[model samples]
Target: MMEHSVIFPDHRKVCALGQGTWKMGKSALREADEIDALRAGIELGMSVVDTAEMYGNEEMVGAAIRGLRDRVFLVTKVLPGNASRTGTKAACERSLNRLKTDYVDLFLLHWGGPHPIEDTVASMIELQQEGKIKAWGVSNMDVPEMERFYAVPGGVSCAANQILYNLAHRGVEYDLLPWCRERHLPVMAYSPADEGRLSRNPVLMEIAQKHEATPVQIALAWILRCPGMIAIPKAGSVTHVQENYRSLSIRLTAEDVDLLDGAFPPPVRKVHLDSW
Candidate 1:
């Protein structure tokens, strides 16, 4: 497994395996099984976990990481509609309570709609001051929106930006990725496998065959090659988690990277209309 400290500007070292808790619920993985999966992830050196109040899995995550809280970098998000400073503060406290923790390592603005972005960001800053959250950022934000946040007085550093980026969905490459790179902000890629689409791509298959690795590894390896980039892939089972961890060892050549890039071009038009 890949074991390395991913340092943010604030000098925090986060684990790269970042367990995604979107599927951690009785309906999804069963409460007991979810806890087992989380424990296994930590044993395998995964220290960062991504979750949200909207996911209904906070309690499960809290229960799983109860004793290991300090060793994990817990991140969660707030819904955009709850932009009122009071509402945001209440949400943070509720999340802390649900997670059975004193504070989250990072709190993200889930999106930039339903309320003025400024209102929500300002609230996030206030939460930081009160020590409810250590750092704050935005998810699904575009270039202009990110720039606006960066310009705010006392605006926290854009520690990380979460978005859908993979070999198949390289739309962010046209602008967002480069912008973050220039600003020294890490791009946390969700769906780095293209929702499993890249696992079946013929070009990736050929590359995987060359290295005796799975296509998923090749895709993740490509993402790791970029500076200021990390991927959070959800693994519901031990086998899937192991597969994702092995991605760190599959080194790709410069030629391989070029081939994969050519094989999977960025989308020419917007595919998903619904807001993430």
Candidate 2:
């Protein structure tokens, strides 16, 4: 198997920086601009580019990684509503066609839905066995659901867990993080800046001033500091991509980390899907 730097424990790589393709398919974004942003991200050392079949941005991502396919660690999710073995398998094939690749570095179940999780997980494993994907994981899953999924045969090998983790929403800190630590499952944080909230927070701004760094950089760096954590903040422009990359350079001191951790602790949110 090809070795990847982004892989965390259990042979998963830290998907260094990635471009989320949600906006690429928007009617407002001109094709040229979308392509430009993707090219910029690749040039800037963001090897992982995340997309989803539901996003309708797979074609754009496929175009972006055309010549650079070998270097990029492509990841995409299958929507939960489409979870049957046949549906899932067909979706993966469609994604492969749209992505212009035979296999993806990681394929994730977008969310836990009504379908039998075990059935979908089994299909995912079959894909891996067939060399259609290198690894598999789940997104937007909580500690209990994650545990349940892991309990399924051939499921404990889940490589990563993508969640909405950021400075403002650190609820995962209480249980998810520790659970992942025990299983060696890397946590892939999406919206690490809380949709630009942390990027402009007053407290974060003050901390950034002390370090002479941008608040967004501080937030992303903080996420990266978490054990077995990786982040995939979206970049809509080249400037934003450059700015996000700068986060990798800012090293938070022990005191700085403590202050930030105490200042903005995890929020209490309705995390249980059972309630939803």
Candidate 3:
């Protein structure tokens, strides 16, 4: 198996793949499936769980990771509108309550909003000091927006930048990914399969056939191959979760990557950050 880990600036070696609970709470009928799939991911060594207060599924994630709290690296996001010092603090508390955890391993700003980044980062810092979050970061921030945050006091400490990244959306590679690399900040790819849309791509299908895996697995393995990057691909069932977990073993060669490049070429120009 091709085992991999994303070593963050803090020296934490987290699993490259994680569980994303974005739409896992869509219906109460599937809560059992959601919970089992999440726990199954952890059991399969995909121990990073990324959820968001805005996702409205923290409780389900909480239930999923119930007895396995100590084994999971928990992450959750606060909405951008709640980026204020007070709002950020309150939102994190609410998330913690929902997650049934005392502290979140990572707390993120879902995206840039009307609130000031400095104030928001400051609030995040305070939260860190308060032991509410192990680390803090932003989501969907382009290089320019990140530069603005870097100007703030203690902004250089931002741990990770979660963004829309996948085979289809390689825009971040133009600048943001490299910029984050220069700063030693890990970039987390949310919706690494383009929210499952990449599964139908013939190019990926060809590559998947070479590896005897699904197109989604090939796309995810590609994301995991990047330096200082991690991907959280949501799985609605245990089978899907296992498939994602197995993607770590699907090694892509230079030829494979080149082939993918032809289909989903790297971005040469700056593309605005695509947020949910």
Candidate 4:
């Protein structure tokens, strides 16, 4: 099996193919299936589990990792509306309660909020000091926003930047990706499959046939091609998560790369960072 992992600035290593719970926890009917899928991923070497309070699924994640917490690299986020110095801490506590864990391996600011970055940074640092979170990061930030974030005191301590990145969403490749790479900050690619849009592409299907893999796997493998990057695709069923885990073994050749590049052309000028 091919193992892929991302090392945070703080040197904490997690699986490059993490489990995403963005749309998980909404339906009670799929609760057992969701939990089983998460556990199955862990069993297959995907130990990084990303969740958020806004997803309203922390409790579900909590249940999934029960008695298996130490085996997982857990991450959750603080909502931007609750990103104040005091509100950040309060929000984290609520997340912890929902997660049933004392501390998250990583905590993130969901996005740029009304609160000052300085205040959020201070609160994040305080949370680290209090052992509520091991590290902090941001999500949905573009290059300019990242620059502003780094400008704040204590902001440089950010461990990673989670963004909307995938084969179809290559806008970040224009500048944001290089910017993060220059600083050696890991970029977590969410919605890596583009919500299954890439699964039916004729070009991708050709590449998948060559590799004997699914188009979705080829798409994900394309994102994993870069160093200092992680791809989080939500899989709500055992079979789906198994297929995602299998994507790790795919090694796209240079020809495959050229083919994909020609199909989903990389960004030319500086395009605005895309988000959901």
lDDT of 4 by residue, 128-180 (tens): 99999999999999988999989999989998899999888899898998999
lDDT of 3 by residue, 155-261 (tens): 99899999999988888888888899998899899999998899999999999998999999999999988878889999989999989988898889999999999
lDDT for each candidate structure: 0.78, 0.79, 0.90, 0.91
Per-residue lDDT of model 2, residues 1-276, tens digit only: 011135554464544556666656676547667777778877777777888998898988888788988778789999998878777888899999999899998899998887888888888999999999888899989988898997888878788888887877777777777888887787778887887878768778888998898999899888876656767888777788888877777778988877886788654653432211
TM-score of each model, in listed order? 0.91, 0.90, 0.97, 0.98
| 73-103 per-residue lDDT for model 1 (tens digits) | 8889988777566778888898999999999
TM-score of candidate 1 to 2 decimals: 0.91
lDDT score, candidate 1: 0.78
Cα deviation at 207, candidate 1, in Å, is 1.4
User: What's the TM for model 2?
Assistant: 0.90
**Candidate 4 residue runs with Cα over 4 Å from true position:** 1-3
The global Cα lDDT (0 to 1) of model 2 is 0.79
Say which prediction, candidate 1 or candidate 4, comes out ahead on TM-score.
Answer: 4
Q: In candidate 2, where is summed lDDT lowest over 10 consecutive residues?
A: 1-10
Off by more than 4 A, model 1 = 1-5, 26-29, 266-276
